[model samples]
Target: MVKLFNEPIILKCDHCGKDLFADSQMSIIVFVEDRKNKVIKDVYVCCKLECDRNLQEIKVKEGLIDGWKDLSDLTNPILFLNQIMATFNRMKNGWIFEPNAFEKLKEIYLACAQYVMREPTESEIKRASDILGLPF
Candidate 1:
């Protein structure tokens, strides 16, 4: 998942297509498929918080609210990755992060690298290296 964010890519509101930047007050909702795969279903950016709430209600009514959570709550990288891989034996679409959320993904990858390097087994080191696409 090599996302090129070289330029200032303006993200849009998933519902209204309004221009949104990284610093905007936005809400990101991820949909988890069977507790194994996660996909960003929407990124709601609105001037009023009520608009974002309204959109979320609509999604709930449409049954698209399965395993949804606030992006801010995803603070634990290892736990987040574990949940994404809980039922799946192999990695899949859940491993991907939305382009706007690339910074968070980088942080998680870095955390994973640090974790695995802390008194890691040979095999664990290799696995982490492979996952991070780094030559260890």
Candidate 2:
């Protein structure tokens, strides 16, 4: 007998509206469960921390807390910036299956900006641009 996978026909990123390929390394899957209703809602997003953050925000707006890690832990600006660059470099070097490093970088950059309460400095932008070889 043969078995079949139950992949959804149309799985788009809950945060960025990007198409999510089944079982792809570039995809992040979140299963939110409601114990009272005994239902699980599957959330699919691209492999970016910003996407996860956005999903948590949306859930908070809806009064559902799934006990995700606190975003406040990323408050250290220098460390946060390092993480962004590392993730970007990995994606660019084909460590991750995603071809679009810009999307991932943009998401992380926006999150960093929000935390810092200011737009990215010219130097920061230039650094990222130099690494990715794309005009930021």
Q: Rate the local accuracy (lDDT) of all candidates.
A: 0.43, 0.47
Kindly list the per-residue Cα lDDT of model 2 for residues 1-136, writing each as its tens digit: 0111122134456777775443234555443434344333332344347777777666544533343212333335775576567656754654432234344434434543444445557787788779878765
TM-scores for the candidates: 0.32, 0.31
**lDDT value, candidate 2, whole model:** 0.47
Question: Which pairs in model 1 have colliding backbones?
Answer: none
Model 2 residue 57 CA deviation in Å = 1.1
Q: Report how far residue 119 has shifted in candidate 2, in Å.
A: 49
For model 1, residues 1-136, the per-residue Cα lDDT tens digits are: 1222223234355566664333233544334222333544333333235546666566544434434343322334565466446524323534444555445434333433332333556787678778987665
